[model samples]
Target: MSEESGSLNTTAAVGEKINAISDGSQIISAGRAISALVSEYVQESYCYRWLTKEPDPDVIVIDLRETYAFGPFITLLDQLVPHIEDAWQHSRVGAAAERVFKRLVEDVFAPLSETRGYELAAAMLAPPEPPERRNATVDDSESTEDELS
Candidate 1:
């Protein structure tokens, strides 16, 4: 099959798996498939090479936004959010899937400045900080201030 046809087939397969996910194991499996597809795309795309060579954060950000492959990649990743959340509630596989997903995103954007890379990856994959944790941190800081006073 032509490369484009092969890629489409792979994407379709992954999409089907994503839609069919009913448990944490399936979520992890789908995530792995996505990582593989993204890895292949990065290895073959000019954007990766350009990202490696480019030094300017502004330029990197612009190119990332403008690249033809980026839009579809982002969309694919976006589709995983709800599934990941559902998986998190029931099994340990959510953590595994999260690690794989985060690593995949970080690797793709690693060529950019650390801050920029993190910003982009966090934007794409970082789950919101749990409200309880946020509140605990705030309470701790307030207590510390009271003690100091």
Candidate 2:
């Protein structure tokens, strides 16, 4: 069969139970499927590392940058956002999925982003702080305290 017809056959072959579902149910089910996919994807790839809250920012960014995750994640999120918004405006199950999606963004994703670790990757890689700032608490002025008194 041609590619288009092949895809139609595959879709139609989901079994009679799914074929009998209403359009609203299909949309809702799709939303839940998407939500589960995203959740599993993030947890397996990103969230587990993130939730560690590693002490060193360099370590965190280095871990995250592995396999070039950041760029693709941004792309996926951008594409998903519009679909999620449309789902929210469409059906009750979609609305519930939207809530789950929003919580994922706000509670988990936002804090990870606000850490600003990605932006600091370079600074973390750079050489240590200059000598002058090392003992900043020490008074290094030309005049001593005795002279000032």
**Best lDDT goes to which candidate?**
1
Compute the lDDT of residue 103 as modeled in candidate 1.
Answer: 91
Q: Candidate 2's residue-wise lDDT over 1-149, tens digit each?
A: 59999888877777655756644596888988999998888778866777866677555435443458686787788899999888769989987988999999999987776676854875688899777776663555434665788
lDDT of 1 by residue, 64-143 (tens): 54569797787777799888878786777867887888997788656554686677977889799999999999999999
In model 1, residue pairs whose N, Cα or C atoms come closer than 3 Å (at least 3 residues apart or on different chains), thus clashing, are none
In candidate 1 the C-alpha lDDT for residue 58 amounts to 67
User: How well does each candidate superpose onto the true structure, as a TM-score?
Assistant: 0.24, 0.22
Error of 1 at 116 (Å): 3.2
The total of clashing pairs for model 2 equals 0
- Among all windows of 10 consecutive residues in model 2, the one with the lowest summed lDDT is 58-67
Residue 1 of model 1 has an lDDT of 61
Instruction: Report, for all candidates in order, the number of backbone clashes.
Output: 0, 0
